[model samples]
Target: MRNNLHSRKINFVQDFLRIQNEAVIRRFEDMLRQEQLKLAEADLSYPMSLEELNTVIDQAEKDDRNGRLTNADDLKKEIDNWE
Candidate 1:
């Protein structure tokens, strides 16, 4: 048997996808479809609306300045609590 790099790569990806549970693959496909739709409708030349994004950035900066942030321990604890 001879090995081809492109074929090997394709087989690896196919195996990876096959190993994923059906429900996970379906959900991933749905997310990919949604992202494709978003890209299709996106306007590259459109100016960004700063009002909402600026507010979010300002809030994040304020939190950082005030030391209102989580440490690794806090993040681990939060993840542990997740359902």
Candidate 2:
């Protein structure tokens, strides 16, 4: 019974793929790439101690309150000016 149910699920997926248009296939490919990127990033991450995490979060909040964040475009322009 389990094997029959699994085979039906696989057949449904195969049938769906067979009918998808080029645009739909491209969208699926893009989604798959995004998922792969997320998986790769997950593999590189390590857990931090609670104290260290809290310290980092506190520093971020402090920076936000102090208006210490730089705009991405402004930072890019500044770097270009350096060169």
Candidate 3:
């Protein structure tokens, strides 16, 4: 049952990707890149003290509330312009 569900999910993703235009696929890739960067940054900060981690989390919340974060699409455009 677990394998069947996994297979179905994989098939669904495959079908979705097959129908997406190049621009949509590129946008999806950019989103994945942004997520990868966030994960990498989190991983690098793994050795932080509890207080430091809490401070970092609080700062992230503040930035989010203040609209200080860049969206994946804008980041991708900025990166592309750098090339």
Top TM-score hit: 3
Candidate 3 — which pairs collide?
Answer: none
When sorted by lDDT, best at the front, the candidate numbers are: 3, 2, 1
By the lDDT metric, which is better: model 1 or model 2? 2
lDDT of 1 by residue, 1-83 (tens): 35588789889688766765888778878988999888867855465588977988899999999999898999999999999
For model 3, what is the alpha-carbon lDDT of residue 7? 100
C-alpha lDDT of residue 67 in model 2: 98
Instruction: After the best TM-score superposition of candidate 1, give how far the Cα of residue 66 lies from its true spot, in angstroms.
Output: 0.9
Give the TM-score (vs. native) of candidate 2. Answer: 0.40
Q: Which segments of model 3 are wrong by more than 4 Å?
A: 1-46
The alpha-carbon lDDT assigned to residue 63 of candidate 3 equals: 100
TM-score of each: 0.33, 0.40, 0.43
The C-alpha RMSD in Å for every predicted model, in order, reads 15.1, 12.4, 13.0
Task: Give the 10-residue window scoring lowest on summed lDDT in candidate 2.
Answer: 12-21
Report residue 15 deviation for candidate 1 (angstroms): 46
Question: Over the stretch 1-83, how does candidate 2's per-residue lDDT look in tens digits?
Answer: 99999999899789867975988888777988999999988966967789988999999999999999888999999999995
CA-lDDT, candidates in order: 0.83, 0.89, 0.91
Model 1, clash count? 0
